[model samples]
Target: MPTVIALTRFGPPEVLRPLRIETPRPGPGQALVRIRAAGVNPVDCKLRRGDFAGTDPAGFPQRLGNEFAGTVVALGPDVPADGAVAVGADVVGSATAQAYAEVLVVDTAGLVVKPPPVPWEMAAGLPAAGQTAHTALSQLGVGPGDVLLIHAAAGGVGTIATQLACELGARVIGTAGEHNHDYLRSLGATPTTYGPGLLDRVRALAPDGVDVVLDLVGGEAVTTSLALVQDRHRIGTTVDRRAVEEHGVLRVGGRSLPALREIVGKAATGRLTLPVRTFPLREAVAAHRLVESGHVRGKVVLTV
Candidate 1:
């Protein structure tokens, strides 16, 4: 048996409890992984709090977590024994609702190689945020000379998006807390604190005007972006469904294996950085609380 954190019932972080489950065996095209680290994402918190209660059909005791990094402990019968995903290969991937466990089965196709230079913690943090940032930038067509405005730029996805935008030759203006402003600048973004005076601050930073806006924080940020950029198509968001429906700003963030692979490669060479706050697997309640706080500098992860 392996212990996994499961929702006893949807409520606060206290609702999460460790439950023992029968060790899962992989079927064809799947592999059994012994998880070393799992990323704690905001969506996991949303699910636990029943944010999507009406539309989500999952019952009680549902598992949380979408990204993980670990070692392949066993391979399915049909999986090639000598392939890149062998018995002892270290790997990382998105495993919807299943990564917060000691062991779990996942499709081999979703796994990306964890390079020697990338630590288990960083590898675990990359999948969801990396894919989301990459896809969002692609959807926005970010490129040379574009001034990209990233709201909540100190968070997991924002941290990666800031670096990727700079890599694409764009000038990134990231908004975070006063403390995180310096951190954003180190990643090649012009930093500004988000709030009442945001519009004026951004105007001063990029006097030529912002070419694109990627809003990670909803609410006022959406309205702020609307005023800065003229083309609604150039304004995108990972949050704010209401804004998408009413204002026609593009909704971003989706799975992209190629993008995940590219991100992992960059992280391996030190071209990318994703700071993580680690907690023991059994301390999942604390991890969930941290993610729900909305003030995490980088990423929060559970070490299994």
Candidate 2:
């Protein structure tokens, strides 16, 4: 039997409990991984609180966590010899609400080879935030000469996006608290304090105007982005769905294997970096509380 963290019912972080279950076997085109680390995301907390119950209701004892880094223990039937991952290979991938377990099965097509230089904690944290940031930048056509404004730039997704955009030759203007301003600068962004007169502060930095916006914080952030950038299509949100329907602003990000590999490579070569806070697997509840507090500088991970 393998242990997994699951929510016995929809509620707060306290609902999360450990359960012993039969080890899952891989199906065709899948692989069984012995998970080394799992990332704690805001979505995991939301799902636990039944935030998306109408669309993605959870069954009792439902697992949490969407991304993980681990080693392949077994390959399923018909897995290609030249596939992206192989048995005994170190890998990282996204999962469907099941990465919290000690061992789990995942489709081979979605896994990326984890480079030797990348640590387990960083690899586990990369998939969701990395892919989302990569996809968002691609959607906004962020590149050379583009001035991109990123809200919540010191957070998980924003940190990666800032570095990636800078690597792509874009000038990044990132919004964070005064405390994280210097931190954002280290990641290649011109950091600005986010709150009260945010528009004016950004204007002072980029007099020509911002070409694109990636909003990780909704409400006022989206409103501020609309005021700064004229093109609705160039403005996107990962947190605000209401703004999408109301303003026709683009909703960015989807699972991308290529993006994952690219980010992993950058991280391996020291071109990209992610600050991580780690906890043992049983402390998932405490991790959830920290994430829910909304003040973590970077990513939070569970060591399994």
Candidate 3:
């Protein structure tokens, strides 16, 4: 039996409770993984609490994990040829539902291998947020000589996206709370204070205007993003789902993606870096509360 973590109800982080059940066996094209580390994401909490209005919740006593870095312990029949992932390959992706457990069931398509170099926690936490940043930049056509603005620059996606934009030859200015200014600078971004005259701070850096924006914080940030860039095509948001449905903020490519393969490749090859804070799987409730604090400097993970 698997001791999976689930929320019997939706409320505070305390709702996340451990429950024991039969270990799942992968079907024809699946594999069973012993989760070494599971990534903690805001979307995980939002969906867990039914606070995310963009889609339906996964069902009560819902298992709560999207990505993890783990070893393949068992393989189902007809698994991918090459069997590229052997019994002990270190890998990451979104397949850890009730993943904050001893073991998990996974689909290969949701998997990305972590070469011997990356640590388990970093590998576990990078996939989703890194991919979201990658897709946002890719879709906006951010490149050399571009000027980009990234909202919530201290958060998981913002930190990764800032570095990526800088690597693309784009002059990146990031909006984060004043406390995180130095942190953003370390990622090669010009930190712009996010409230009260946000554009003034940006204008001080860009002079002309930004060429693209990746909004991780929604609400007013969506309007602020549009106001900074003339072309609406240049702005997109991952958190602002309402903006996508009503106000016209474009949906980023990776949101609808089953998994991010090539972008994860970037992290695997050292083209990207993941910043993470980790908690043990038994501390799942505390992990959710910490991330929800809105003061996290980077990604968080639950260690199995």
Candidate 4:
């Protein structure tokens, strides 16, 4: 049996509990991994709390985790054994919703070799956030001379997006609390406090006006971006669905394999950084609660 973090019912963070289940075998083009760390994402918390529509209660004991870092233990038929999928190879990759366990199977196509220099906690945290940042920036055509605004810019996705934007020769204006402003500055973003008069503050920073906006915090953030950037197609939101429907703003964010590979390579050379807070796997409740707190500096991870 393998122990995994699962929700016995949909509710608060407390709903996440450990369950024992038979270890899953890899199918063709898949690899079995012994997870060393799993990334605890915001979506996992949302699903557990039943915040997202269309969740069925019949899916109780549902697992929650989309990214993990570990070592390959076995390969399924048709998985090439000479590469990152080989047994004993350390790897990191995305999953569906089954990563928060001691062992689980994931598609071999998703796996990237974990550079020895990257710690397990950091590697576990990369795939989802890194890919989302990469995809959103590309979709928005973020480029040189552009002034990009990223809401909630100190969290997981924002952190990655800020650095990637800078790498693309774009100037970044990142919104965070006063406390995180200095941290955002370290990432090459012009930091501004987000709240009342956000538009004025951003206008003060970029008198020429913003060229793009990536909203991680919903509500007024989208409204603020709408005011700063004239191109509706350049304004994107990862969290707000209503704003997308009502305002026609692009709903942006998703995983990309090529993006993750590039991000991992940058991380390997000490270029990208994502600070992590870790807890033992059994403390997934605490992990979820911390993420739900909405103030974590970078990312949260469960160490197995």
Candidate 5:
């Protein structure tokens, strides 16, 4: 039996409850994992409050959490034989819904092995934010000599995106709150404070123009991003799918296309480094509240 957290209803963090239940046997093309840590994101908070409207309504008493790091312990029929899917080793990626549990049953394709020096918490934090960073940067053609702007630079996706863009030799101007300026700088992002004149600050940094803007803060930033960047192909939105679509902003967030394996591989080998603020699984509600409160510098992970 395994214990996991489930949200009873769409409400504040208090609605998240824990329960002890039996570990599920892997179904076809599935693998069972003894979860070490679970990544918490702003999306989890939005889903808890029913803020975003997109996915087909999941059955009630829904399990939350997406990215997680764990070890393979059991195999479902779907896993290929001949030891291609290694068991009893460190693994990381997304799950269908059971990530909050001590054990997770996920698609074999979703799982990837973690190389040495990649901490479990960092691995847990990678799947969602890492993929978003990778896809958004790739889609925007972020590269050397490019001046780019990234919104929410202190956030999970922003932090890694800043690093990746820096590694790729792009001049990254990142907008976070005043408090996070130093941290953003540490990650190799030219820090700008968001709110009350983002464009001006960005222009001051770039002088001539910006090649791309990854707008994590949707709404007005999307419009501002397009205006700031020379090419529309370089602007992307990770948080708001609808607003981006309505305004025709580029979208790099998940749209049923799973990129966890690729994301995990990058993070595991150090091409991507994610920060994890860790908490115990029993504190799932507090973790959700932490995300909802919106002061997080990076991803939050729940340890089981």
Candidate 6:
């Protein structure tokens, strides 16, 4: 039997409880991974609270977690023909609400090799935030000479997006609290305090006007982006679906294997970095609370 953390019901962090279940066997084109670490995301908390119940209703004892890093313990039928991954290989990738367990099965298509130097905690945290940031920047056409404004720049997705934008030669202006200003600057972003007067402050940083905006915080952040960036297509949001429907701002986020490999390669070569806060697997409730608090500077992970 293997232990998995599941939400007995949709409510709060306390609903998450450990359950012992039979180990899952891989199907065709799948691999069974002994999970080393799992990432805790804001969406996990949302799902627990039934935030997306209209579209993605939960079944009782549903698992939580979308990304993980671990070692391949076995491969299913027809899995090793391409030679991309094999038994005992270290890998990282996106999972579907099932990464918060000791062992789980994943499609080979979604897994990428985790570099030797990248720690399991960081690798686990990378998949969701890394892919989201990469996709958002690509959607916004962030590249050389572009001035990118990133809301909530000190948080998980924003941190990766800021570094990736800088790597792509964009000038990044990131919004964070005053406490995280120095931290954002270290990641190659011009940090601005987010709140009351954010538009004016960002304007002061980029007098020519922002070329694009990646809004991780909705509401005022989207409103600020509308005032600062002229083109709606160049504005994107991961949080505000309403704004996307109303203002035509791009909705960004889809996992790409190429993007995952690229980010992992950068991390391996010391070109990209993500800080992670770790807890043992049983402390998933604590991780959820930290994420829900909305003040964590980086990502949180559960070690199994």
**Predicted structure with the largest TM-score when compared to the true one:** 1
Candidate 2 lDDT tens digits, 1-304: 9999998889989999999999888999899999999999999999999999999766787998999999999989889765668778999999999999899999998999999999999999999999999999999889899999999999899999999999999999999988898999899999998889998999999999999999999999999999988899999999899999999899998888899999999999999999999999999999999999888787999999
- List runs of model 6 lying over 4 Å from the truth: none
Q: Relative to the true structure, how large is the alpha-carbon lDDT of every model?
A: 0.95, 0.93, 0.80, 0.92, 0.80, 0.92
lDDT of 6 by residue, 108-197 (tens): 889999989999999999999999999889988999999999999988899999999999999999988888999999999999988899
What does candidate 5's lDDT look like per residue over 135-208, in tens digits?
Answer: 78888888999888998888998998898889899988988888899998888888988787887878888888
> lDDT of model 6 at residue 97?
94
The predicted structure with the larger TM-score, 1 or 2, is: 1
After superposing candidate 3 on the true structure, give the runs of residues whose Cα lies further than 4 Å from its correct spot.
52-58, 80-82, 253-261
Q: Comparing candidate 1 with candidate 5, which one achieves the higher lDDT?
A: 1
Taking all chains together, each candidate's TM-score versus the true structure is 0.99, 0.97, 0.92, 0.97, 0.92, 0.98
- At residue 2, candidate 2 shows an lDDT of 93
Clashing pairs in 1: none
Off by over 4 Å in 2: 80-84
For model 5, the superposed segments whose C-alpha errors exceed 4 Å read 52-55, 77-84, 255-271
CA RMSD, predictions in order: 0.7, 1.2, 2.2, 1.1, 2.3, 1.1
lDDT of 4 by residue, 1-304 (tens): 8899998778988878889998889999989999999999999988888875474544667888999999999999998888757999999999888899999998898889999999999999999999999999999999999999999999999999999999999999999989998999999999999999998999999999899999999999998988888889999999999989999899898888889999999999999999999999999999988999999998999999
Which 10-residue span in candidate 6 carries the lowest summed lDDT? 78-87
Q: What's the residue-level lDDT of 198 in candidate 6?
A: 88
> Model 3, 227-299: lDDT tens per residue?
7887777888887778888767687846423335665667678876777888988899889999989989888
Candidate 1 lDDT over residue span 186-237, tens digit each: 9999999999999999999999999999999999999999999999999999
| Preferred candidate (TM-score higher): 4 or 5 | 4
Q: What value of lDDT does candidate 2 attain over all alpha carbons?
A: 0.93
State the TM-score for model 2: 0.97
